[model samples]
Target: MAQFDSKFHDMTEGIRAVASLADAADRLNTIVESYGLETAAFLTVSPVYEEPSKPFYVTTYSPDWVKRYIEKDFFDIDPVLRHGLRAVTLVDWKEIDLSDKAVRTFFGEAREHGVGKHGITFPVRGVDGDRGILSVTSNENAAAWQAFLKSEARDFQYLAGEFHNAIGRIQGRPRHQTVCSDREIECLKWYARGEKVKRTAEILSLSPRTVRFHLDLARAKLGAKSLAHAVAIATERGLFFQKLF
Candidate 1:
């Protein structure tokens, strides 16, 4: 029992040290692979403001599924996702019906890919009004997959939440916005491009005083001691989409 306890502690700590979303996903894939399970499908969703029917944000998903879903625009017929949002706990795909002809056709096409027929989806409620879903699919029976998920539920949920939070911070949509805004984002974008405040002001047809005001605001929003520090913060938060160097 002591040895088992030690191993559990080590596993938890090791997973916590994963620094990026990609790292976390790879780690999860490795874990499932180790158990002789093939996890070909994984997806995360967050809240989207427009379209009440489509309030969830699909933060990440398999590239193949993304293209197929978009090309087909199956969101309108994705009954499982629609029902899952209303469920209070993790749901199994088998429990939801795809009896509708359109829904049935979509699932049939998805099956041609490696995506599983059944899976468990964990709903993640974040700080503020944001919410998300972390789904894992398997080709096996829903009951068997659910049992496996139940055994590793805590670890799976932890990894999912960590991934989501990391992405949120990188996407500049963190639960707690330390320093970020539209003005700060604009200033940082210009700063990254090697533009001085005077030149930036001239380009924007603003006075030097106004440029300084924007810069100051950016510094405050970024929690930076200087203009350079602010730019660094913005870059890490994914505001600078282009390569600076």
Candidate 2:
């Protein structure tokens, strides 16, 4: 018991140490692989339904699957994800009703894309209304799948919580702001170019305090956890391509 506890501790610590979202995704893949699972994904939903959904995902699924999933906007209707988002406890895929035509079609496509036959989703409810779902899938037969879940479900929940907390720590705060002023845009550009507040202030002939203020506003507008995340969001939206680097 002590040995297993130690190992779990080490694993969660490694997750907390990840430096980037991509690195965190890779780590999730590693974790699922270690557990003999086929694939896994951690998904976060934006509170406002109409807001442009930023890529807040970590998944071990194939690129083809990822692209198709996005192109189809299938997430809005995915039974596993929809339930997990609202479910207070872990949701097992096998237990859910699959009688609906749309649900059947969705699962059929999922299997074609190499998603496994069995799965479970652990919902994570965080402070500040942030929510996420950690899903694990496998190709195992029904009996074996149930046995595996009985043994591993608790541990999976713990790992999901750790990963969520790590991501939250990196993100700094719950992002919701979505507008930036002209000066804020300027500050973000300079910051993206590796300009510190002091250097950017000098270049813009503004005080360091003013430069920082603009950057902070931009970060909030972008709903970024940090300036680095703000830069990533801007780049994703073609905000950086407007000006020559």
Q: List the residue pairs that clash in candidate 1.
A: 46-57, 179-221
lDDT of 1: 0.58
Give the per-residue lDDT of model 1 (tens digit) for 149-233.
Answer: 6565544544445545554654467444323335446656787689988888887787776566557655644547788887887
As a whole number from 0 to 100, the lDDT of residue 92 in candidate 2 is: 84
TM-score of each: 0.54, 0.65
Off by over 4 Å in 1: 1-21, 40-63, 141-143, 175-245
Q: Supply the global lDDT for candidate 2.
A: 0.75
> What do the candidate models score in CA lDDT, each in turn?
0.58, 0.75
Backbone clashes, candidate 1: 2
Q: List the residue pairs that clash in candidate 2.
A: 171-225
Poorly placed runs, candidate 2 (over 4 Å): 1-3, 47-55, 174-245
Score residue 147 of candidate 1 by CA lDDT.
Answer: 81
